[model samples]
Target: MGSIVLTHLKSAWHVDQAILDDEEKIVVLRFGKTTDAAVMAMDEHLSKIADRVQNFASIYVVDNKEVPDFNAMYELYDACTVMFFFRNKHILVDCGTGNNNKINFSIADKQDLIDIIEVVYRGARKGKGLVVSPKDYATQMKY
Candidate 1:
């Protein structure tokens, strides 16, 4: 249900424009296929918080197979990858997952996702290229 509502970047140009054009809000892009389970799960979390974070972030999902333009550049090799951008600059978060380049896993909790986006928004507004995630994914106890 959530995945059905989130906006998707269908082309390479749309993907570039989404990052390049949105000047005020952080552009959050989820790279993967909508048909994939992990990507759909991530989209659920994202869409759940879409309205809540609209003041500072704009969420968009892109199908890697369809766009394919940013896959190699961003090293998108996971089932689902969530990336952030601010003022046309890529925003990196230290999720403690060894890979700060992008969130390469499905965040189980939506609050966890909100925390990350808030951290990114605050840090990017201050002109910081990278920011530490609120919770360390590497250390969080799994249920």
Candidate 2:
């Protein structure tokens, strides 16, 4: 139900506007299907912290199937991809997964997601296009 409440970007124009129009808060776009297991998990986590990080970030969900305009540009091939942007600049996150692009996995922990969002917001505000994630996702052992 969390995924149902979050704002969904339905077109290429909307996506572009979301990226371009936000001059202050960090824009977070989740690209994937809400029906997918991993995406559902990620969306749930994102929804939980939407309010906590509302001051610094704006979360929006984009269905890859609906908005295929960014498939090759941003590489929306993952089951779930979370990308960040600020002031029309794409903000990359080094998640230690060797992919300094977008987060292509589910982060189950709410606090962990919040921490990462905070880090991204802080870095973006400082005029940095990329920020290192608080958690080295590749190094952590997942149960």
Candidate 3:
């Protein structure tokens, strides 16, 4: 005889606090305005815990003004400014554009579009929870 059992699987969404708390290194990609003050502030904060943080943490500022092709700015970092963070496993990406509302959507400027990159990066790194089929049939059948 063949029988089928169905179980409910709950998925939880959470920020990987460990990723930030235990991070030994942090890399920031500053484009557009490229604020030195912010960089200095972050550096100062990180320096306090430098002893506990054992990895290499550095900030790279890439001014979009220097780039010959503005459109290529997105491509500069894998179609997103935050890609560097993913590539280097950094905790955050501060693109110099203050907040989402501050961004000028009317313009396709690199600075304005940086937020899009940030959003995509945030979404990929911390996915929203959704109920889906389990990888193992036995686990699914048990619920």
Candidate 4:
């Protein structure tokens, strides 16, 4: 039940504020509907790292259907999409999956998700807009 502990952003304004307010931690936003299987799986991984990564990352879940404010802007049409933000700027990751904007597929393992978050945190802290993922997700991701 990681989803139980994760905060949900129901409005675009709240989502925007979350990214802007966190100066030290990387704002991780999971954009998707709670009812989707992929979204549920991703939320599980997010919840697992909620406490462990709190010092460097802040996680939030946004129901795209409920908000719909960022759907068009962020191109959040996938079953589950995760985006990283630092200092109100969108951080990109080179996942070796062509799509660097966000992790569109559900990561089955918790450690893998944690590793990715760590990479983003380190890169963002260094003033890098994009960083390479530690592991190649092209093979691991099928969606």
Candidate 5:
């Protein structure tokens, strides 16, 4: 239900404009199949926190099938990928997952996603292209 309400980027032009139009706040793009379970989970988490982080971030969902323009450039081959951009510059987050490009997995916790957005927002405002996540995904214990 949470995933259903989030904004979706319909075309390559909309995606490009989304990245180019935002002068402030982090542009969070989730690129993947909207029907996939993982993507749905991530989208749910994103939607829940969209308003909480609106001042610092903007979340947009882009269907991989609809916009393949960034697949190769961003290496978005995973089931669900979340990337960040600030002032038209790509913002990388060190999630301790060994991959700093984009979040390629589903994050279930809304607070966890919020923390990450906060970190990314702070780093972006500081003129840093990359920032360390509040929690280390690589070291977090999984059940």
Candidate 6:
């Protein structure tokens, strides 16, 4: 497991490492906030969850500077928000409001992360691209 810290909009966030290990893609847990305390709190919460999972993991914080070699799957253009990505695909989690300002996870537990890895890896093997929304894929169709 590896991790990286990045800064965005003057807020510091620690997120999961973006390394691919043993064919298992890394999970990126992003935390964004205007205040440092709130960001730290979110980090603590995610750390606790990661501890419980006992899976290979890393963490990072998002910032304004674009991370080299890192591809963005989704962008939460609002206040402090947390986002997770596996194998370049966004992990859709339910966080009540469904807004981009809060942390949400619908998959229940860490096992879900593992499941995402397996599914994404399998799809890649079959040359099946990740399923994205029609609007998001409109440009591809144009080609």
**Per-candidate total of colliding backbone pairs:** 0, 0, 1, 0, 0, 16
Q: Model 2: per-residue lDDT, tens digit, 1-143? A: 78876899999999999999989999999999778888888888999999999999999999998889999999888888999999998899999988888888768889999999999999999999889999889964322
Model 6, residue 21: C-alpha shift (Å): 6.9
Model 3, span 1-143: residue lDDT tens: 00011111111111123223323333333333223443233233333433332234333334344542432524433212322343334332223333211111122233323333434344435642111111212211100
Higher-lDDT candidate of 1 and 4: 4
Q: RMSD to the native, candidate 4?
A: 1.0
| RMSD of each candidate relative to the true structure | 2.0, 1.8, 21.2, 1.0, 2.0, 10.1
TM-score on alpha carbons, each prediction: 0.94, 0.95, 0.25, 0.96, 0.94, 0.43
Provide the lDDT at 114 for model 1: 88
Clashing pairs in 1: none
The CA lDDT at 53 in model 5 is 96
Off by over 4 Å in 3: 1-24, 33-56, 68-84, 88-143
Better by lDDT, candidate 6 or 5: 5
- Candidate 4 local distance difference test against the native: 0.91
Clashing pairs in 5: none
Candidate 2 pairs with clashing backbones: none
TM-score of 6: 0.43
Best by lDDT: 4
Model 5 scores worst on lDDT over the 10 consecutive residues at 134-143
lDDT (0 to 1) per candidate: 0.88, 0.89, 0.30, 0.91, 0.88, 0.39
For candidate 4, lDDT tens digit of each residue in 77-132? 88889999999999999999999999897687778888999999999999999999
lDDT (0-100) at residue 141 of candidate 6? 13
